[model samples]
Every structure is written in C-alpha cells, then in structure tokens.
Target: AQPRRWPLEKHEYKRYGRQLIMPEVGLHGQLRLKNARVLIVGVGGLGCPAAAYLAGAGVGTLGLMDGDTVEESNLHRQIAHSTARVDMNKTQSAMEYLQSLNPHVNYNRHEFHLTPQKAIQIFEQYDLVLDCTDHPTSRYLISDACILTGKTLVSASALKTEGQLIVLNNPPRPPGDALGGPCYRCIFPKPPPAESVLSCGEGGILGPVVGVMGVLQALEAIKVLTARAQRPANGGDWSTNGATSEAAPKATLLMFSTYNTPQFRSVRLRSRRADCAACSAQSTISRQSLTSGSLDYVAFCGATAPINLL
Candidate 1:
C-alpha cells in the first residue's frame, strides 16, 4: 500500500534479472516497479494480459477492479481465467492468477463497478491507472477520474480485429497546466452514437487482437514507472510519475489492425484542449461533480452499461 520501504528480495534480483540489465529498467527502475501501485479497471481481455506482465515484472501493488464474473465465453480472450474459475468474480479470478505469477507483489480486489463516487477515492490509492474496460462510458469515467486524481492513464480498447491505445494525463498536472497531456474528454469530447457502440460479444474479437493491446498497455506502464526511477536526480515530482522531465512528451495514439497495410500506425495528438472539461484550463469538471454523481456517464456516452454480475 506504500512505496516499498525495504529492498527487493534476493529472489527478486534474479527474477527481474532480464529487465534489470536493460538501461530502461535497471536496479533503480526495478525498485520503482516494486514501489509502484497500479490499478487495472477491467479484468477482461485487456486487463488479463496487462496485469500478467505487471505482476511478472514485480509491481508492488496490483489493483484489480471489475464487477463482472468470469464465464465460459471469456476463456477465449481472457487468458488469465481458467475453466474452473468460471462464474468467479473477475477481480478475484485475476488476483489468483497474478498472485500466483508473483507472490511477492501485493494484490487488491475491488469487486465493484467503478462509479463516479468511488472513482477518485479508488484512484488516489494508486500511482498509475490502466483503463482496460470496454465501454465508452467506462473509458470516459476512468479518464476523468485519472485526471481528477492526478494519475497518469494508459487506456486501450479492442473490437473485432482492431485495437487502439492512447496514454492520457501524462505528467498528470492539475487542470490548466499547458504542459499536461490531454485526457479522454480532450481527445473525444463526445462519445460515438449509441447505435454505433458494440461490445466484443457483439462485434467478435480475435483472441490475439485484444491480447496485443493489453500487452502494450503493460509495456507503457513499465515505461512510465521505470522512467520515474531516474527522476530524483532531475527534480521531477511524484505527480508526473517522473515519467518525463520538465515538460510532458508529445501525446500519441497507436492503432493496431490485424489486417492492414501496416499493422501499426502512430497518430500524434494535440496538447490538452484549452476548454477540455476534464483536464484543461477552462474545465468544468470537479471532484464534487464527480462524487455527487451529477454527471451520468452512461447516458452521456450513450453506451451499453457493463453487465453487473457481482
């Protein structure tokens, strides 16, 4: 629950030996991961692979958030769930797998859907957040919470054979900071038409498609945490996760398609919008509005509510 006060165990040095050798994740970087608290807000396709890698990498605190239960249908793409785990709370199922992967890492099980009232409180406990949920409503809610909590966000989604990824709220500066990266609302002020929204259950995703996106989410998270390992020397603060120095890096959106001229395309993103309601200077969103549930994310986004099986 706190930055690791002790040192990595002797086993950890060997466990993370491969990454420890890399300049990107040297001894100090490995320590950053051990002291990191990461939250994954969905234990489905994307969250599964993302959590696996983070656990394997020895992230100290791994928070699994989901209200759904595992089912036979999820076995195809939800790699962490086993046949025996069917009908188990998703967060519980993931915790079992992740804990097994690395018993040294701590695990938190949040067996509830992320609502506006709980978003900020939950996000405040973690240093970084992964938006692995499938719906636009959840995406918007997650982003807003991350922005409000000043936590960096690694968000991704997959449908059918395609997946998209974007990192938001980097350097997680307070609203109005020109150097801060954009939030979900800045890039997508309006959600897609309700009729256009479709779940993987309806659209059909290939097993590997979503998994790829999830793995990429873990990679970005490591980059963010490990980058912070070098921050103390540069005077970067904790709010930014010390992912970068004085200024936030240019934001970008990565698109991956199973069938395309190029499998990967990187699209540069503009800085936080001056009027973004979530992460910009002229914003109207606040902790009060979020906690009071004044805004209806599902209605606003016109997306299907996730099935609540918990």
Candidate 2:
C-alpha cells in the first residue's frame, strides 16, 4: 500500500496549475514531490538549476551543500548566485535565491565541502541525492556514499558540449527485491586519470548544456519519487506510450552530445554487478567500513586531491 499523501492547499493548487494538468503528474505525483527531501551536493553548474526547479516544484525539504564561495566568473552558469552575493558561500547564495522562489520549502544549508567524513551523515537525512560536484574525488565520494547509505542518486556530468545523466541505486519496487539499478561503481569502477579530468572552470562549458542536464536531473528525481510501488526496479526506455507499459521504466544511460545530428541517445544499462565492491552481496563498503574510514575513494579514482577523510 502506498503511504498517505498530504493534501495540496488551495494556494498550492493555483500555483502549480500547469503541472497539475499533466496526466502523469496529477495531484498524487505533486503531493509526492511536496513530501520529498532532496540534497543537492554542489551549488554550481548543475546544482543551481536542479535546486531551482526542485524548489519551484515545491519539494518539501531542500538541502544545499557546497563549500565554495561564489565568484564573478560563475555568474553565467550558476544562476542561483547573484552579483551582490559574489564571494559569499555558494550554499548561502543559492539558499537566498531558493527561498525567494518558494518559501514553502524547508531549506537546510551545509556550508562545507562534501568530505567523506560528513557525506554519509548528511545523506542519511534526505530521501534522494543529486551529485553536481565537479571534482573527481568528490564525485567518487558522493557515489560511494550514496551506495553505502542506500539513497537514490541522480548524478549528472557536463563537459564542453556534452552531458551525461543516470539514475542510480534506486530502491526496488517490491520491498525486499534485489537492488533496482547499478550503483555508480558498476558503470565507473575507477575514475579517469587526474590529469585528464577537467572541470567546467578549466575546460569551459556551454551554459545550456549543463542547464539541460540539470533540468533532467530534477525530472528523473520526480519520476522516481512519484512512481507507483509496482514500477520496474530496472530502467526503461521512453516510448510513444510513455512509461505506463511494464517495460517502460528500466535503467538507461542518457548521453547528450550537442554537436551530434541527433543530440540525445538513451542506452539501456545492464543489471548490477555481483562483484561490485559497494553494492554487491559481498560488498566491502559497509557501515563498519564507513565508520572506520577504510575506503580510499580518492586514490581509487586516481584523484590527486588531499581528501584524507580517514
């Protein structure tokens, strides 16, 4: 049985009229969004737009986690920060804008870098997590932490004119079934060499590319949160019939190349790996591992950062 949903207020119904009219997202879906608790781990590029849309959609609890301060150069892509807020922590700046967009959302600010020491603790507070950080170390950390905590993860990456989106480790539709999708480790067991990793600041990015990916991140999160209890544990393809069919909602990887003739391609992904160190039957990443700080995600990812959470 699905849990009871809170009723929408008269003002809320009026506010979200356009969305409420959609057959896929009527009153029930909107209520699910309103009750969701989402944590955004970076307030730049991807996080800004994702947080903005989630707030506007009335996600009940929105958490902003980032340690960096806003810089003048970030104005183009980080829409949540303003000229007046330059040099302020990104979390604070984003929160200022988000609250203005929807005061109904309960905002939590984590004005610190997402270190492994705090990743699991903070992730436990949210039903879903968005990985918008650019650092290789941070990405691996977020991925591992989400798998460890069993939180649904919507992770996206944008570089130049290219963007990628995937939903990972969502809970199975039926309560005790195997994991619904692959964890980040199943796809990228090791991060790229540090020398080859270039952030948006270093390599430059088309604003619209990241914007598009960020918006899709929010859309995926909404779908996962509102989906029926019997929805497939795996990913599905987008069909003319939409995701109503049984085979419509399986795990798929989206690759967006703005330069290509057909810019978007969705490839169905395989099931979880039995040998995955994080989410497998004999997984090494456990609560004990986390508590002992035994995992070396930074080193495993070939990152050169000094992220010694242990």
Candidate 3:
C-alpha cells in the first residue's frame, strides 16, 4: 500500500508552532507563507533584519539582490553579514545566515545592482518585493517594475536617526487601473534634486532606526501574505478560528524617529493619481521604455559632481 502523506512535514508543525497556532498565521496562513516568494533588494540595514524574520516565518522562497560586498562598516547596522563574512557579496553573506535560521526556505542570490533592464524580469519571479535600498532612483525603478509585473512592494529607508516606510503598487494592479493603490511616483512625482541625495554612509544611519523599519517591513509582509477573506462558515476549512479579514489596508506613509516625543505617525495617502507617470491611465512609462534604456532614470535623477572638499 502507498504511504500516507501530510500537508506539512512533521517537523514543520513544531518549527512554526508559535505562529502556526495563531489565527493570523495558523496552518492555512503558514501554508501561504511557505508557498510565497519574496525578493529583498539591497541587503543592508533594512534588509538584514527583515530577511531574518521572514526566513524564520517560513517564506517559501527568498531572493536577495545586492551588488556590494560586505564591509566592516556594515557591521553596525547590517546584522546578517558577520565580520568573518566581510568582503563577500551581500546576498551570499545574508543567505548563509538565513539558511542557518531556516533550512526550509529556498534562497536566490542576485549579486548585481538593480537596473531598469533587469527589474521586470526579476520582479516577475517573486510574489512581492522589499525595497530596502536608500536611494530615490532605485526606488522609482522598483516601484515601476512592481507595477508592471503586478507585485506589491514594501519599501523602507533610514538615514540619520529617521526612517520612513511605504507599501507601493499594492494588489499589483495593472496600469490605468483607477482602483489600484498608488505607486512611488504618485506620492513623490519627482525625485529629490540629485545634489540633495545622501547615502547612509555619507550622512550616517542609526542602527536601531533601520532595525525598527525592517522589522515593520516584515510585519506588513506577513499581514499581506496571510490576509485571506473569511471563508464560508459551512466549510470549516481553516485549522483554527483566528484567521479573519478586516477592511482592506489603507496606504499610509509611516514615519519614525527615536528622539521625537511622538515617535510614530502616519499620513493617509490618496488612492491613485490619474495623471501619475507609472501606474496611471496616461502613464508615460512602459515596459519598452524601461527596458530600452530610453527611460534614463539616472539622467532623470541627475548625477552630482564629486565635491573634492565639502
């Protein structure tokens, strides 16, 4: 006789026991997590902690994208890459740690900077994306790619004790869909002047500021992944009663600061902008423009001259 099969391996029940027992992430939710694919771009301060939590939660597949190698300076905030792993590609270093955390998760290492040409093809492979990068050009590229491929984006950034979080292109609605949530461009129609852009290395980033944002990114991702409409009561398909739905989540800009009296605040965002360049009905951005090098995002953002003496 054929051997009996189980929905989850026996060890998995014990491994994800805590979350597996919660209504928010019961058996069904755990299964969703196990089947989902998430890509994290820029495995630095924000990506490190976010990847750790998601890996522990059993996200089936994780794609880590980064071109930079580990540096001693990264130790202060990039938690996954260790001192021993210094000089290694960021994705490889992070994957080594994540594998130890959860042997069950499948990891892909994209060891290259994200470019407009490469964004769509890579974005298509994953269910969702985390924009852990700290620059605006890459932010626009990520958002546009997520919109084109119909994938939600959980993007966050931290610099000099301040951090902000936003989920863009949620529900993965296609271009011209009025019901679609806003893309990054809809909120900030223009990138900040290139001269004004500052990297964490240049301006400095507080360790916990980014750590908090990254953890929140993982939390939001879990919410999005496990969110299921309540099934008919007659079926009783869910393993437990805790998995229930609420009204769809609103798109809000979450701002954080450790020094502020009120450390957390949210600004509600408009749904979709009809005139938005990326996701709107009259969008000027298209797959062709993105892939053809005609878009010229770097030029759009401008390249600042090196200041020999600031």
Clashes of each: 0, 7, 0
Runs off by more than 4 Å, candidate 3: 1-4, 230-250, 305-310
Clashing residue pairs in candidate 2 are: 234-250, 234-251, 235-249, 235-250, 235-251, 236-249, 236-250
Cα lDDT of model 1 by residue, 1-310, tens digit: 7887557778888899999998767888998999999999999999999999999999999999999999999999999999999999999988888878889989999999899989999999999999999888888889988988899999999999999999998878899897878888988998999889888989999989999999999999998888852445445344745444565455799999999989999999877888888887778889999899897887787655544321
Query: After TM-score superposition, what is the CA distance of residue 100 in candidate 3 from its true location, in Å?
Result: 0.9
Q: Note the residue pairs that clash in candidate 1.
A: none
Q: Estimate each model's TM-score.
A: 0.90, 0.88, 0.91
Candidates in descending TM-score order = 3, 1, 2
Kindly list the per-residue Cα lDDT of model 2 for residues 168-275, writing each as its tens digit. Answer: 886532212254567777777777887888878789999889999999998888888878665543534455443443331345799999999799998888667667
Best-fitting candidate, scored by lDDT: 1
Root mean square deviation (Cα) for candidate 1? 5.0
| Inter-residue clash pairs, candidate 3 | none
lDDT of 3 by residue, 21-114 (tens): 8776789999999999999998999999999999999999999999989999999999999999999999999999999999899999999999
Local distance difference test scores for all models: 0.88, 0.81, 0.87
Off by over 4 Å in 1: 1-6, 228-249, 303-310
lDDT of 1 at 189: 92
Output the better candidate (1/3) by lDDT. 1
